[model samples]
Target: MTNPRADRVRDVAKLAQRSARTRRGLFLAEGPQAVREALRLDARLADDGAPRLVAEVYASAACLERYPELDALARATGALRTATDDVLAAMADTVSPQGILAVCRQLDVTLAEVLSRGPRLVAVLCRVQDPGNAGTILRAADSAGADAVVFTEGSVDPYNPKTVRSTAGSLFHVPFVIGADPAELAQQLRGAGVGVLAADGYGPVDLDALQDESAARRLTVGPPVVGPLGDGTLGDRALGGGANGEAAPEGRSSGEGEAAPSYALEAPTAWLFGNEAQGLSDAELALADARVAVPLYGEAESLNVGTAATVCLYASARAQRRGQRTG
Candidate 1:
């Protein structure tokens, strides 16, 4: 084993973390599965895992003086802990350090890259700041045969440990992108020829309403409806939200078809979900041509972010599947 006395505090590991932070493109992963995921990341962050033996490590000599076990761990592991307890706090994601962390690079992709050929489905994480919620949505996106997933500006980083774990290994199954600017995103989707849709928990139309009789359809979001495309023209477009904000553009389309024609949900589309605390912003919402929601029969005020998102995306997947069969 390497000797702690021979190692410096600013070794390769610390440098790697600094680089990642500087570039806004680095993450650290611990455990075998997380390491595997790091390797698979488009921006491969690390190939090896930092090992913390059954010893303690202190961030500083003062900390060591305060907590002798931390020093003892250093003696055991041969890795020098930094000089700041706060640094350790930030680095230590768990209540206790696992002694194993893998540094990784972030994969920043564009709209075109996200919507690569294969399927015509899209998952939009508008402002879902909960890392777990974000990751779970990605997992669902992969499971539902999504072509890609888009994360808006205010969303959490998908590489967060909590978020990554929530994915349940779905990170490798599909591609996801980040859209930092709503206006830029709108242009990109329009350029890519991908329809943009938003999820409204209290939307007027049912999600199933996006379908056409002939199997070709726009992306539908909302609850399941009785009739097909354009069947239920919502006169009561009352939206229940004061907790969110948005910056969508004028004349932006959310795939609202004119007049009820036999429509289907087989068209290429992207669906945007919102934050755990608050839903999508008002300005951002205007970008959507139409909105839909799940009809919760129970008296629950609203569903949790994960449950609601799953319902929205799965509804689209189901519509597309049926459309494909008919087509």
Candidate 2:
């Protein structure tokens, strides 16, 4: 157990600041959800081994009694530590501490490694400054079954305590990279046969139009039509695996008058979203193969980054899983 004034406790408290976190190579997971996820994923933020993820846990006695699962995780990881309520409060970034907190290494990966998987769906956040919006987008990406999310340079740090909390534990579920170059990322994804679409308010391609085109194409070809090669030519390998003319999965059809199946969303796609206030810059959006505008029915203003991303990513998920039906 440690008192609020102890040196070690104070060191942990210092991580609340970005500068301290950068120097120490650690961040705080302030609540049960984030802590449990850190333990479950056991991702290695640094090259070191044996320490594992979730190096230490601090909880008040009342917290331990209330959330026995968290307590068990601490015990199982050999990371259990005791702190008085006041000590825990001093370490927390939130007003209402969840009574549990963990010291975790930052979670991130190289962009090359992220793209090596040949991801089917991805979201790229460009210059998005809000931590809450960033975290919510991550949660939406996870929900949409996106293979990964990329946080470009000038975007919020994924490990920011508020962002981590906003994810509600989804930060551990999906692979993400921070501080990546937007143009380079687009080049890499295109090289991997992934189509990059920029989500802009005045883009050329319409989301619903893409859906309609997808539904119509699915009727002719067996599966959703992934784009041709980077050179804008229809190579045999255009549709990813379906490029080899692999037959669509059994019992799938785009019947006439039926709702436009979300087949376009199925194609290997990555959506680039800009910041809330400024949106994507002209130069930044120019890197994409195409620009997609989310159709707004109501007269209300534009969609926020998080909501727009959720709609875009899930549209792809639904399109991709259209005939597969596995969930």
Question: Among these predicted structures, which one has the highest lDDT?
Answer: 2
Error at 97, model 1, angstroms? 6.1
Per-residue error at 39 for model 1, in Å?
4.3
Lowest lDDT sum, 10 consecutive residues, model 1, at 241-250
Q: What TM-score would candidate 2 get against the native?
A: 0.84
Q: Where does candidate 2 stray beyond 4 Å?
A: 43-51, 222-224, 228-263, 323-327
- TM-score of each candidate? 0.64, 0.84
In angstroms, the error of model 1 at 127 is 2.3
lDDT of 1 at 272: 73
State the TM-score for model 1: 0.64
Tens digits of per-residue lDDT, candidate 1, 161-279, equal 67766786676567777645776776677566666666765444445444333233323444433222455444333223223222122222323443223223455667777776678
Each model's number of backbone clashes?
A: 29, 1
Model 2: residue 261 alpha-carbon error in angstroms? 19
